[model samples]
Target: MFTGLSAFPLTPVSGNAGIDEKAYGRLVHRLATTSVDSIGALGSTGSYAYLTREERARVARLAVEHADGVPVIVGIGALRTRHVLEAAEDAQNAGAAGVLLAPVSYQPLTDDDVFGLFEEVSAHLSVPLVIYDNPGTTHFTFTDELYTRLAHLPNVASVKIPGVPADPEAARARIEHLRRLLPATVTIGVSGDATAAKGLNAGCDAWYSVIGGTFPEPALALTRAAQAGQPERAERDSQRLQPLWDLFAQHGGSLRVVAAAAAHLGLTTPRNLPLPLRGLGAKEHAQVAAVIEKLQLHA
Candidate 1:
């Protein structure tokens, strides 16, 4: 359903309670004006697990309404198959181009259990389904065998791999392994924001990105260079983003960093995430500002 950079905006909740609808409109508008191939609503960066179903549905509607023709992909992952089906229905009704599905789990899942989840969802989905293989969050890893099987399922369009091994040689080899097994039409998306540029160079078709969702221009620069085989330029720009990436690594990853950076840039209101997951403090906020300003990305 997509290729190139698919930017996942942090779901901005207004200070009072629910999603900041106006702020979300502005966020989607900002990304739609860029070279991004798609805008993903409720991806991990969007805090999908924290929001209520009503909020998730509302976010999907607002994202599609303001995306200005850029395809809006909603993260519709839920622990139960029935819940996922309901969210998929919401996404389709809201006019999202596709729905991102992950195998959310409390109890461990067997391969048949995981495959059956997609099978059930796909049977009811009219829109394309992006298989989110984020073991870090979902705790369910897709073996190559499983991915091969899922890739053959109806409505399955892409697979978002959350990690590409850090070693360049191993990373490329892993990409090749997936390429060898997956259906030719299925796009391989790389999602580790810290190493996205390298992943792009390693042959991932799309960057299912975190940092790029907040600061797309620089991310696109890196993606373009790598896609065009200009590794040196890609590396240079990726290096420029190292400071910001460091903050993500240090401060509970992209969910916190993007929310903090978005507020710092005045792109969204100052808001805390759902409880037990606090926003960045003053010290970390200062670090974000310094890095954004240093890279001249506050533009």
Candidate 2:
């Protein structure tokens, strides 16, 4: 579940209608039919922070039900430790193979505060846990010392680090440094879709991808090529999808752009994001459509 391409799908929510179960299920089922290694439900890409506990739990069940034997990793992050534990329990009861936890808080967290949360939660979890270190959303940067402490916890299976350096040597060194600090059992997975191939080629064990959820084939191609030790092939595959990555940069972030792509593909309705968050406009959607058509990402 921790290794390879773990695709995070959006939790398609229609305004006031709550979760669009059919569309969310469609997204998970689509990935299950492909070669993705695992399904990541309710991660940052899935808008886990925006949904209620009940909605998140239902989404977890739906993902597991439609995954077709692929392992499901459910995100269980919240502002409070108690709430995080509740979410974790719900995910485990729903048959998630593992749970992903990010240290989210309204106020800035000290290293001890973050460590204590993991210590308490890790002690109670039955399934494996992935340490989600997404500083962009959480605003909490993780030092190597913190990672070492968390990696030693009983169910700490992997650490999902942020993007690596763009230069090949720098990326390799960054991954290598983390490898030395973390225990041998814990794998290092990389986020930042654009740098996924570079991370993998540099020795990261997996990719926690956003685009892989919506378009599995291309992500799988790049992942497989990297895992097979064909770095050049992986790099070439990533280069081909530069347009889509560019759209992610231009359209704020991946959530809006991917929601737009999903809508454009008819996998979900337009404006599928939760309230206060809008999908791409007509001009942006047209641009995304053109890129999809040109890339032949019809899958």
RMSD of each: 1.3, 0.8
lDDT (CA) for every model shown? 0.87, 0.94
The C-alpha stretches of model 1 lying farther than 4 A from their native spots are none
Model 1: how large is the Cα RMSD against the reference?
1.3
lDDT of 1 by residue, 102-191 (tens): 999999999999999999898898989999988878888888899999999999999999778878888899999999999998999999
Evaluated with lDDT, which candidate comes out highest?
Answer: 2
lDDT of 2 by residue, 1-299 (tens): 78899999988998667999999999999999996999999998899999999999999999999999999999999999999999999999999999999999999999999999999999999999999999988999999999999999999999999989999999999999999999999999999999999999999999999999999999999999999999999999999999988998887679888988899899999879988887777998899999999999985
Lowest lDDT 10-mer window, candidate 2? 275-284
TM-score of 1: 0.96
Global CA lDDT computed for model 1: 0.87
